[model samples]
Target: MTILSYADSALSLLPPVVAIMMAIVTRRVLLSLGMGILLGAVLINDFSVIASGQYLGEQVAGLFWDDGAVNAWNMYLLGFLVLLGMITSLITVSGAASAFADWARNYIKCKRDAKLLTMFLGCVIFIDDYFNSLVVGSVARPLTDRYYVSRSKLAYILDSTAAPICVISPVSSWGAYIIALIGGILTAHGFTDSGHLSVFIQMIPMNFYAIFALLLLLCVIFWDLNVGPMRQHELNAQKGNLYDEAKGLPPGANSDLPEAKNGKILGLFLPIIVLVLATFYFMVSSGGDVLAADGKPFSILGAFEHTDVASSLFFGALVGFIATLALVLIQGLDKLYLTKGLVAGARSMLPAIYILLFAWTIAGVIGQLETGKYMASLASGNIPFALLPAVLFVLAGLTAFSTGTSWGTFGIMLPIAADMAMGTHTNMMLPMLAAVLAGAVFGDHCSPISDTTILSSTGANCHHIDHVITQLPYALIVAGISLGGYIVLGFTESLMAGLATCSILFVISILVLKFKSTQAIS
Candidate 1:
C-alpha cells in the first residue's frame, strides 16, 4: 500500500507495456486495463497480494473521494459525460437528430462532403480537445451516417484534430498549460528576452507532429486515403455496415428507442449552441477568479491558464441538458418516452465511463510508479547537439505512450528538454521544446488508454478497439513523417528545411495512397 519509486529501473515500463499488448491482442480494453492495474498495484506493493488488493481498492475509492473530500474534477467530468449522453439521447428521441440529418441531406450531396464537414467542425472546435472530440462527433454524426462514412473514420478525424489544434492555439486549454510550463522553464534557464506566449508561437512552426497530423488528416479526407483497417471499415460503410455490430454497440449510441417523427432541426442546434457558449463563458469566468486570486490582470491567456476545465464542462453540459429536455417536452413527447430517453442515455454512457475509470486508475498506478520519470531518465546523457531535437521527440513520444498522458509527458520532458537544449544546444531550444509537444501528441494519438482517444471513440459511437485498430496505421505513418522532419531540423537547424521535408513527404504519401486505392479497385 506504500508508494515507491521505480524510476531508476526498467520495472516502471512493464505495466503499460503489458496493458497495451493485451489490449491489442485480446481487444478487451477493460480487462486489459484491469490486468495492468493489478500488475502495477502488485509491483508498487512489492508483490504482496493483500497489500496490492488494499492498494487497488484505495485507488478506485480515491477516484471519487480523495484527500478527505469529493474529487471535483473527476466527478465533474463524469457528470459532463452523463449529461452529454442524456442530452444526445433526448435530442434524438425528440427527432431533432433525424430532422437535422434530413435538412443536412439536402446540402450534403456526397460522402466526401459529409467527411469534409466532419473534419471542418473538428478543426473549428479548438477551445479544448475533450470538448472538440465529443461536440464535433455529435454534430457530425447524423450527416456522416446518412452518407455512410464509417464511425471509425469519424473517430479518426476527431482524434487527429482535437489535440493537434488545441496544442497549437494560444487561446486553447492545452496551449495555455504548455505556455505556462514553458514560462517556468524559461525562468529556470534565465531567459528573459522572450516570454512564454512568444516562445509557443515560435515553436508552432517547429511542432512537426501536430502540423503533419493535421495535414495528413486532410489528405486522408480529400483523397479518400483509406489505408489498412480503415479501408475495410470504409468499404463496409459503403455497404451500409457502419461498424462491426458483432464487436458490440458503440457506447454513445442508443438503438432501442423509437424517435419521434416531428423532430425539428432546432432541437439539435439549440442545445449544442448553448453548450458551447456556456462552457466558454464558464471557462473564462472560472479562470478569471484564479487570475484575480493570484493578483494578475485579466486576459484571455490568463483565464485559460487558470481555468477549471472539468467544472466548466460539467456546468455547460448541465445547461445543455436542460435545453434539450425543454425542447423535448415542448414537442409533447410522452412522459414514459422521456423516461426511456433518460435511462437509455445514462445506460449508453456506462461502458465509456467504465473505460475512463479504468484508464484513470491505471494512469494513477503508472504515476505512482514514476513511469514518466523513468522514461525521462532515458533521455539524459545524449551525445550530439544536432540530434537533440530528434532524440527528445522520440523520448517524449515514448513517455506519453507509456503513461497514456500527453500532459504528463509535457510536464516531465519539457523542463528536461529545455535544460538540455539551453545547456548544450542553445539555438535549438525552441525546436527541442517543440519536439516534446509533437512527440507527446503523437504518443497520445497511439496510446490505447489515452482519455482523448477513448472519448473520441465514444463521441463517434465506434467500437473502441475498432477505432484504435483502424487509426493506428494513420497515426504511425504521421509519426514516422514527424520523426523524419525532426531529424532534418536537428541536422540542418532550419525550420524551413524540416517543414519542406514534411511537406514533400506528405504529398508523396497522398499520391502513394491514391495509387494503392486504384490498385485495390483494379
Candidate 2:
C-alpha cells in the first residue's frame, strides 16, 4: 500500500499546477510537461529522483500495454490523428483540396459569405473536433484568403464550430465518450437502472455553453460581430494584413499548398463522407443495441451508449486515408510520388502528438494522485445546493482552461460531479452534468495551450498565440452567459425554459454588440 497513491491530498494538485505555470511562463509546452511529469514522479516516489527515474522508465514501457482499455484508447487516438493528417496531406498533394476551395470560391462573394461557408463546413464535419478544425481550415482557408478574411477569424470560425458542434451532436466521438462516462459513473454508484444515453440526450438541452456558442458563432459570421482583438484583426485583414506585422511567429508550415491544376471536388468530399459513414457503422456495431421501455430496439442512442469511439475514430480515419489514396491513384495525376503525403502528413502532426502524449501522461499521474477527488473535497463545503451547478460549471471551465483539455477535464470532473449529485441527492444532476460538459468545452475553446487551438492556428496559417488572443473574448462572452443560465436552471429546473431564456439573451446581446461594432466600422 503506497502511502499517498490514492490519497485525496492537496499535494496531488502539484503536477498540473506545475505544468500550467511552466507552460505559461516559458511558452514551451513540451519542456513544461516533461518537467511536471518528473516533478510528480519525484513526489510520488518519496522524493527520490533515481526512484522516480525508474518509475518513469517503467511507465514509458507500460504506456503501450499496461492496461488493455487504456492502451487501446491511446493507440486509437494516435492512429486516428496521424491517419487524418495523412489524408489531409494526400488531398493537398492531389490538388483536390485546392480544387475544392476554388470550386467553392464562386459562392463566396463577400467576407460574410466566406465566414459562413467556413462555419458551414465546420458544422458538417462534426465527426471529430480535430478533423473538423483541420479539414475546414484547409478547405476554406483559400476562400477566406481571397476575401481578405483575417486568418484569426478563420481560426475562430474553425474552432468555434468544431468543439461546440461535437459537444452537442449525438453522433460524434464526444457523444460516445460522454455517454460512456455517465454509464460508468452511474454503474459504479449502484444506480444501475439509469440510462447514461438517455441522461446525455436530456443534458443536451441543458448544454447552455454549446448552444449559445454555436448561435453566437453564426451571428459573428453573418453580422460581422467583430469585437476586441478580433475587430482589429478583421480591420487589418481588410487592409491586406493577414496577421500582425509587428510580431514574428515561431517557424511553422506556411500552408502554401499548391492548387492542383487537375483535381476533383468529389475526391475531397467523398472521403469525408466515407469517414462519417464508416465511423457510424463502427459506432452502432460496437455499441450493442438494447430494448427500450416500449420493448423495441432503442435505436441510435442505444448504439452510442455502448460504442467504442476510440476504435471507431481510428477506423474512420483509416478508411478516409485509404479512400483518399485510392481516389488520387485512380486519377493518375500525381502517380507514385503522391504516396509521400502519408509520411508528410503524419510528420506534420508530430508536434501535436507530442503535446497529447505529455498532457495525457500528466493526466494519468493526476489520476493516480487522486487530484480530482481532492478538488471535489476542497470545493464541496458550504455551497448551497441550488448554486452547485453554476459552481461546478465555473470550476470545470477553470480546470479545463488551465489544463487545455476537455476530455482530460471530463475524466477529472465527471466522477466528482456524479458523486456530488448522489451524495446531495439534489436532482440537479442533469444540469450539473451538463455544466461540466459545457464548461470543459468552453475552457478548451478559450485556452491558448489547447491542442485544438494549436491545430486551428496551423490549419488557418495563423500564429498560435494570435488565434488564442482573438478567440478568448468570444469564448468569455458565451461562458458568462452560460454561467448565468446555469444559475437560473439550478432554481427553475426546466431545461427548455432555461434554454429559451438564454437563447433570447444571447441574440439580444449579440444584436446590440453587432450594432455597436458596425457603427464603429462605419
Candidate 3:
C-alpha cells in the first residue's frame, strides 16, 4: 500500500491501542493482543484472507527465525525469563528467600526503611532491567511486607529502577541496544569519522531524562514523598486491604509455599554472581581488544556480537542449574524435589513467554505497516527547531506507552530519531536520541500493561492494578521534571545544566510534599 494510504488506514484502525484496551477490559492479555495482531494484519492487507495468512506466516517466521527479531526474543526476553524462573525456584526450594527475609527483619526496623532498601537493591541490579525487576522484587517483597511497607510501593520501586537504570548503564542489555542504534546513527550522519567512543560519550552528557530520573527516584526514597493516587493506595494498604485474598498470600509470606533448607541462599547467590561475572567476561571478550589472550589482544565486543542474548542467559542458567544440583546433593535433599524445582521455575516463565510472543507479533504488524517512517514524516514538516527534543521525548513516550514495550519503542524510535537528527544537521543529534531513550523508559515505567510492570507486581505479590494506580503519580512527577529538563537542554546547549535543574526541582518537590504532610499531621 502507498505510504499515505497505509498511514491513514492504520491510524483509523489503531490496532495496538485497541488491542491493549481489549486486554485491559477483558483481563485476558494474550487473547486481546492476538486479536489486535490479527486485526492489524487484516487491515494492512485489505482484509484479504490469503494476504493476511501470508503476513501472519511472515511474522511467525521473523519472530522465530529472523536475525534481529529472533535474536532479541532469544537473547533478551527468553533468556532473562528462564533464568529468573530458575533462580526463583532455587531460592524457594532452598528457603533462601525466607531466610533472607528473617535476616532482614532484624535490620530493617521500620516500614520506611524497608521501602528504601528495596529501592536501593533495585538500583544495585543494573545489568538488565528485566533481571532487575524479577530479582529485586522477588528478594525484597517479603521483607518489606513484614514491616507493613505496601506491596504496591515495592512494585513501584522495581518498575521505576528497572528501565531507568538499565538505559544509562554502559554494561547493561539496554546499553547494548542503545550503542547499536547510536552506531547506526553515527554511520548515517557522517559522524563515523569520530569513532564509536566519541559518539557514545557525546550522547551521555545529553541524556537529560535518564540522569534526572535517577536523581528523582533517589529523592523519592529519601524524602518519602507520596502524593496523588499513591498516597491513597498507601492509606488503603495501611488498612490491610491493598490486595485480594484470592490472588495469593499476604504481601510477602511464603506460607503454604515450599521452602528450601539452610545454605539455599548460597544456591541462589553463587550462580547469580557467576552469571554476572561471565556476562562481563563475554561482553569484554567480544568488544575487540578489551582483553588479552595468549599474549595477544582480543575483542570482547566481537565475541558478544556473535553470541545471542539467549546464549548469554543460557550460560548463566547452566551455572544456576549446576549450583542447584550440587546444593541439593550436598544437602541430601531428594533429587526428585530438585527436578520439581526446575520444572516449577520453567512453568513460572510461561506467562512472560506468552507476553513476549504477542508483543513481538504486535511489533511485527506495526513494522509491516511502516509506522516508524510514517511518524518520522509527520514530524519532519511541523516540529519547530527549539521543540525537537521535547517533541521527540513525548513521541517516544507515547509509543512505548501504547505498545507497552520499551525495547520495542526503542527499536522503532531510534531509527526514526536518528533519521530526524541527520535531517536536522546533527547539531542536536545526541540530545534528541537521548530524549528518545529517556521517553521510552518514562512511558514504560508508568504503563499499567507493561511487561516490566506485570513482572514487578508478580514479584512483589502486589495486585497488578494496585501497583499501576499507586505508581502513576510518582512517574508523572518524574516525567514533568524531565519535560522541563528537555526544554532547558534544547535552549541552553548545556546538558549538565539541564540535569542539575531537574534534580533540584525533584528534590524541592519532594521536600515540599514532606513539609506539607507534616503540617497536616500537626
Candidate order, lDDT descending: 1, 2, 3
* Candidate 1 TM-score, C-alpha based: 0.99
Q: Candidate 3, which ten residues in sequence have the lowest lDDT sum?
A: 248-257
Q: What TM-score, to 2 decimals, does candidate 3 have?
A: 0.83
TM-score-superior candidate, 2 or 3:
2
Give one digit per residue, the lDDT tens place, for model 2 in 1-522. 132473467687778788777766666777878987887888788887678878777666566667544588778878877887777777777777777767877766787888888888899878678767876776787678788999899889989988888888767778877887878887887878877667778888788999888888888877788878888988899899887755443212324444457788887889878877887787777665333333556567667766677787788778878898888889785544474676667776666677677767776666667665565565578888778888899888877765678887888888888778888864777788889999999989876557777777767767666777788889999998888888888778767667766877787788789788878967
Q: lDDT (0-100) at residue 339 of candidate 1?
A: 92
Q: How well is each residue in 1-522 modelled by candidate 1, as lDDT tens digits?
A: 467779897999999999999999999999999999999999999999999999999999999999999999999999999999999888888889999999998998888898889888888889999999999988999899999999999999999989999999999899999999999889888887787798899999999888888888888888788989999999999999998988878889888787898899999999999999999999999999999998999999989999999999999999899889888888998887799999999888899999999999999999999999998988778468888888888999899889999999999999999888877878888999999999999899889999999999999999998898999898888888888898899899999999999888888888888999989988
Candidate with top TM-score is 1
Model 2 regions more than 4 Å off: 1-7, 65-70, 183-198, 232-259, 288-299, 335-340, 402-404, 411-415, 418-427, 448-463, 492-497, 500-508, 515-522
Give the residue spans of candidate 1 off by over 4 A.
none
Would you estimate the TM-scores of all the predictions?
0.99, 0.84, 0.83
Query: Please, what is the whole-model Cα lDDT of each candidate in the order they appear?
Result: 0.91, 0.76, 0.68
Q: Using TM-score, rank the candidates from best to worst.
A: 1, 2, 3
lDDT of 3 at 433: 84
